[model samples]
Structures are given as structure tokens and as C-alpha cells.
Target: MRRTTDRTAPPTPPPRADIDQRTAERLPVTLPVTYTIHDPAGPIEGTTVTSNLSGTGVGFRIQQPVAPASPCRLRLTLPQRTDPLHFTGRVAWCRKIPHDSPQTFEVQVGLALSTPADVREEPSFATYCHFVASELVKRYLG
Candidate 1:
């Protein structure tokens, strides 16, 4: 008896060129962060790791569910920064993962800085650069 061999082509995936063009520039730092989730009833606080941050928004992973398109006040504390950053943010999107997963949901929040121009003064970046410069100076001179 001869067995038949079937050769079938696999399905092609959708083109990602449009997605690449529309995607925003993502910063390359994973800053430790603590965020507070503000709701109508009250505020719920949680700890999240900032996957990436830009002048206008940040992406983080949280356990609790946050409604998309809802506005919230966030008190974000970054590592090595003296003062916590506070701002008003809106939930741009939320996605739930599997139940057994450590990260229950991924939330992308868009924050409105107190002043749009104030982003240049983001303490985290400024402080980090200052520290690095200081360290380099010490290493070279000492």
C-alpha cells in the first residue's frame, strides 16, 4: 500500500507596513514605577513596571482591570527620582491576558502633563544623565 503525501501552503499573515508607520516612538528604558488608579468611587493604588515612556504617554502592566477611554489621575514614582510625578491621564487601551499569567492586563495610558512644554524637565531623564556624567567624571579623575 502506498501512502499519499499532501502538500498544502500555509496561510499568509497580514502586512504590518501600516502598523509600523502608525506606531509611536518607544523609549528604551524600563523605569520602576508605582501608579495610583483613580476612580469615581475612590482611588486604587498599584505597582507597575513602566515598559516604555514618552513625553505624552506611558505603557504599563497592571493586575486590575481599568476601563478604556476613562480619565484618571496618576501619581507615578520613578526610581532614583526625588519627587513623584503627578498628572492626569486617560486610559487609551487595556488588554487582559490569561488567568495564570503574572501580568493580568496591559494598560496604555496617555498623560496630559501640567504644561505640554514641561516634558523637557522630566526628572527621571535629567537625573539619570546627571548621575552618569558625575560617575564618568569620578572614574576619569580618581
Candidate 2:
């Protein structure tokens, strides 16, 4: 029995939206999301529900496909917060697939937190991340 390692070869990357690539655990927290994607043609505005939340990003479905790395503005309201948290980040990924019917299509987009990451230490987002960490602890330990 023997094993070999390809040191020079790059490691395989997980597919887009794959859970394995997430550095933090995702909370099945569905929050209200209002997004404005600045597409090249024009700005697309829509309201959709968040599918999941993580320390690094948020996932939601959009009516139109957002190009990867395209800048976008996201307004999300966390639990017990009346004023929504505003985030500006490039679209991490977008997956277009058929939904409800074959004739209809929806795009699921992942938006990374870029602005708040460098602004004011991102207190609001940090708080949410803390909450997620605690919930994960409760699920796995408590």
C-alpha cells in the first residue's frame, strides 16, 4: 500500500454555493432581504427572502442573474432589529436554475460582506455572527 501527493497541483475547489467552502457554519435564518444589483445594463431592484446567513455572507434568490463580482447593495433586517443592516459587496456567486416550473427560472445569489468588513469593525454583523456561533454551540454541545 502506498500513497502519493501532487504538491505542485492545485487543490480542487468546491463547486459554487457548496457548503464545504463556507468558513463559518450557516444558520437556517430566513430574513427579509431587499437587493439592488447594479447590472451593466441598468440597476435591478427586487425584494426577496434570505435563504441562509453566515458570518461571511448571505444567500438569497433573485429574479435576475447577477454577474459574479458585480457590486450590489443589500439591506437585511436581523431579528429584533427594526432598522435593517446595509451591506455593499460584490456578488460572490449566482446560480440560475428552473424553479416552480421548467418555463420559469430563478437565480440564487451569494453576497459577501465587503463593506462592513472594513468599516467601524462591523459591530452589527459581528453581533449576528456571535449569535450564530452561540446557536451552533447549542445545537452541537447544549
Candidate 3:
């Protein structure tokens, strides 16, 4: 008779505590973003589409690797707005998705807007989401 070893132990998963600290509020709209890395010697510019935006930050995809801790200046054009909005941000984390995929990168950036007063005063959260949704549909669909 062959002896079989007990294999009832559950698999241990990697820690995800960092994910809790980095929770972000998602905006309903997709904004067009042009970002430039601020290097003292010179600046490197790149253009990408923002997946979503929030009062605290924005999320986007990069074609290449960007230094995680580097600061960048972002010029975002909202769907409804005619002028581009300018904001500064620090790259919180940059990681390549799909393990072997080299054509795309996911970046989580923390924005530092010029001032707190710059954000519009909306009466409620639903109103804000509605406004953003409307703009996104108008620009993307219309």
C-alpha cells in the first residue's frame, strides 16, 4: 500500500495591507491628460489617457516605466471644460500589468492641485457624479 501525506493546509496569501492605505475614490469621467516628468536637468513629456480622476489624485496608464517617487506636472482637459487644467503630482507607484506585458504600465499618482479652492462646490456626491458622467458621455459618445 502507498502512503499518502496529509495535504489539508490552506495556502498562505501575500500581505495586502498596503492596498488599504492607498484606497482611492473613483470619478465617473475619463479626462485627457498630458504629463511631464519634472527632472532638474530637463523635463520628459508623455501623453496618456486618464482612467478616472478624484480630488486627491488621478489614475492613468503609461507606455513606459516612470520612477515611482518622481514628481510630475499634469495638464488635464475635462470633457466639458474648454481649457486644460494644470496640476502637480507625485508618482506613488508604477507597476507593469500582465506580468510579461511590456507595452503598458499602470500608474497610481497622487495629485497636488494648486489650491483647495480650485475644486467646484457641489451640493451632493450624486450631483458631482452626475456632472462627471454627463461630461464623459458628451465627450466620449457625442
Which candidate tops TM-score?
2
- Predicted candidate 3 versus true structure: per-residue lDDT over 1-142, tens digit per residue: 1312122223447658767654344565566789987644456687877776665567676654555446788877765566676666666545454335666444444343333442455223333445556655666687
Q: In angstroms, how far off is 72's CA in candidate 1? A: 1.9
lDDT of 2 by residue, 102-135 (tens): 8798777777777453544887666666667776
- Give the alpha carbon lDDT tens digit for every residue of 1-50 in model 1: 12121221244476687565433344544666666666444665776667
Q: Any residue pairs clashing in model 1, and if so which?
A: none
**Backbone clashes in model 2:** 0
Instruction: Quantify all predictions' global Cα lDDT against the true fold.
Output: 0.53, 0.73, 0.57
Per-candidate alpha-carbon RMSD to the true structure? 12.3, 8.1, 11.8
- lDDT of predicted model 1: 0.53
Q: Which residue pairs of candidate 3 clash?
A: none
Q: Predicted candidate 2: what Cα RMSD to the true structure?
A: 8.1
Backbone collisions counted per model: 0, 0, 0
- Candidate 1: worst 10 consecutive residues by lDDT? 1-10
Model 3 has an lDDT value of 0.57
